[model samples]
Target: MIIDFHSHIFPPPLIAARDKYLSDPCFRLLYSSHKARLAAADDLISEMDASGVNKAVIQNIGWASHDLCVRTNDYLLEAAARFPARLIPFIAVQPLAGTKALGEIERCAAAGARGVGELRPDVQGFGLGDDRVIKPFVETVAGNNLVLLLHADEPAGYAYPGKGAVTPGVLYPFIAANPDLKLALAHWGGGLPFYALMPEVGAALKNTWFDSAATPYLYRPEVYERAADLVGENRILFGSDWPLLGQRRCLDELKALNLSTQTLNAILGGNAAALLGLE
Candidate 1:
């Protein structure tokens, strides 16, 4: 029961009219290049079959515009409905939209959205630590029993596309403030799990999970072992960041690390299953 915790899919129409979406800075930064791949739900299903992934969470990139977020959320919900067994939709929302964003989340939760995520707070013009700005949104997500996945990046790393300033410093306060939220920080929690070595940080992150979305591009393979040692195997999730990274390629790389079968299995699926309440 292997699950890729982070992946993205677009509607065919959105992919066809990619130019129109480029007006959003985050979209423009990631998709302006012709080489950057834009995959649809069919593409994800095909790749999952080839990679032996049983299920995947469909992520939406941060869109500053509420209209863009809603448009993409509709597509995510539709795609998940079309392939209910294989896809889990994590709808997107521009938290700055206030009540409207909460309404969209309620609507999607009723329609079958399992989570809300891949949120890029920096690009979305909100600080994760800004309780006044995001508390309502956070409350709404929690009320719906939806996991919140935030985009996190290493604060000191070389710049890359979509690498905004949602680093550990910014993420820690939010985690402390909302200790009860089921939070999954994408991209290895921007290296936040490493901080779990500190007693206080570790305590605050009891409910947090980290997804290895594009780890091959970021760290050495030893990261899997090191992160597990610091935060335990249950806190790590296997996320290929599909389209940006291949499912098979990432799996092969992790497999090469020669981790024990138990540890490997936990990261690959066990942890995510428990987190998502999958049977």
Candidate 2:
């Protein structure tokens, strides 16, 4: 019952037009390499099979440019439909799009998108702290019963491709505003769990969850045990950030943690199933 909480895929057509997407300044900045890999649905399923992952949540990114966001999203929606059992769909939206962003969400939801994100406000050009810009996006997601998975980066960690400045300081205020939204922050909330030591901050995180996407890129397998200890096993979701990382590689690292069976099951799949309403 292993469910990967974070992964990405693009349509074959987009992959075919790699040069166009790669030309975007922001895309080039993050990808930093023309050789960067983008997986298609088939590639994802094969990796999932090889890694023993039963299901995966495909996270779409809100590119800095609105048109790219829409194009990437269109491909993601179709891919999810093509492999519904193995892949759950999520759409990307530029909060700066205002009403248009909300409209995009509506379009994807109607087409059967289960959630919204891999949202990178830093690269996407919207400050999570800017309520005027981001409120509509959050409201739209909540209104439609969709999960919110925002990208988070540890402020003190080494620089890497796609690392954003969405640290706890920038994201916590937004989380506080939407207490009811079941938000999952990728990359262990960029070390947000450490703030849970503060009595008041811990109380504000009642609805927050953290995913271990690309753990090997930044930390050791002990991160799983440490994060679970700080935030409880239920707050941790297993995520491979596949293609950027690898599902089998992430699982192998997790296996080294020697976590208790219950905790392991909760992080690997149970928590994601509950969050996603997979039952």
Error of 2 at 277 (Å): 0.7
Candidate 1, residue 112: how far the Cα is off, in Å: 0.8
For candidate 1, write residues 186-216 as lDDT tens digits. Answer: 9999999989989999999999999999999
Query: Candidate 1: which pairs clash?
Result: none
Q: Over 4 Å off in model 1, which ranges? A: none
Question: In model 2, where do residues sit more than 4 Å from their true spots?
Answer: none
Per-residue lDDT for 82 in model 1? 92
TM-score of 1: 0.98
TM-scores for all candidates? 0.98, 0.96
Ten residues in a row with the worst lDDT in model 1? Answer: 124-133
Candidate 2: worst-modelled 10 consecutive residues by lDDT: 23-32
